[model samples]
Target: MKLPPIGSYISTSFIDWPGHVVAVIFTKGCNWRCPFCHNGPLALGVAEELDVGAILDDIERRAAFLDGVVVSGGEPTIHGSLPSLLRRIKGAGLAVKLDTNGSNPSAIGELLNEGLIDAVAMDIKGPWYKYERLTGKAVDVESVKRSVELLKSSSIDVEFRTTYVPHLMDEEDLRMVRRQVEPGRWVIQLVDTRLALDPALVGTASPERARVAEAFPDVPIRG
Candidate 1:
């Protein structure tokens, strides 16, 4: 059987997880086409060479120092066999974190229900009405809703984040997203167009911090 494609890996991280040293695995493929997505290469299903055994070995080498492994994507849940992969990672005795776009509720539910993931960071692309505009595709709004609802009610550690872009992340859209989800760990990140796969996206301005703060007075927002 063909294993899921691995796009890229970060050998070490301080912020991917709160306090743990994490090696982030970027999986190939995504359903949405968010213009501000820096990992456009992965979003387009492009894959570099993958070595699962080498990855596992690297994880093993850092196992003593690292706290967990985060399997993010272009939409990791898009792969039907994600749970099995998570299980393999878990067998190495490291925690796992999943980053998703909230488009695949069923897969996320399985991961959470089966205790395959320790934390989940789901993205709220935009308000329901503007989801298509932000994603550059007609997204399944109901599916996104279901995923958000499931995560909000989940016992697992969960966080909701939005990549802050100038034209994409307007004040009204930000407020709408905040109200949709219950008060919890909400993060609004500034989009860094530099190093983005799409060259046209580079040099575009992100929303100013003051404007973002004005939109979200209490919620923590970062880049």
Candidate 2:
């Protein structure tokens, strides 16, 4: 099986997933063009590339210290070989966490049903119309909607999040997102404008974190 092209790996993370020491696998390629994306190099496949073997070797060395692995992206679900990749990680005896855009629900479902991923973090990148605008793609919002429904009903631990980019987001947008997500584990992330995909987007400011959390009174907010 072809290994997913790896961009980088983090030997340890405390916040990538709550309560787990995770080894993060950064995969190359993405289908979106969110202006505020911090990992633009990964999204554009313009970063310094590394051998997948080296990444796995590093993971193997850290496996004894880590309790889990997080397969993050450049949208991980876009890669066709991710199931096999997840299987290999699970075989290492570490639990798996997948972070996705919810654009490819089937792939997420397949991994979940196959018992490969133990936790999921789906980025609900604003409302459907705004999603197409921000992502720079003709997206079927229903695919995301379906994914949300599946995650809500699935047995695995799931969290929905939105990266708060002030230039592209507002109170109304957050309201719409909250309605769609209901009362699950939701996170409102403050954008790190300094690392945005486009340099022009660097100076934009988001609402105070406390205010953003107050906007969704029923959901939990984390930094």
* RMSD to true structure for each model, in Å: 1.7, 1.5
Mind giving the per-residue lDDT tens digits that candidate 2 earns over 64-172?
8999999998989999999888878887888999999999989877887899988999999997779887787888889989899989999899999987787988889
User: Candidate 1 residues 1-223, lDDT tens each?
Assistant: 4457888888889889888789999889998888788887889887684786688788887788888999988899889978777887888899999999999999988888899999999999878998987888888899999999999888989999987777656777777888888775788888887855546678887678887788688978787
Roughly what TM-score does model 2 have, to 2 decimal places? 0.94
* Worst 10 contiguous positions by lDDT, candidate 2: 214-223
TM-scores of all predicted structures:
0.93, 0.94
lDDT (Cα, 0-100) at 26 in candidate 2: 90
lDDT of each: 0.84, 0.85
What's the lDDT for residue 98 in model 2? Answer: 93
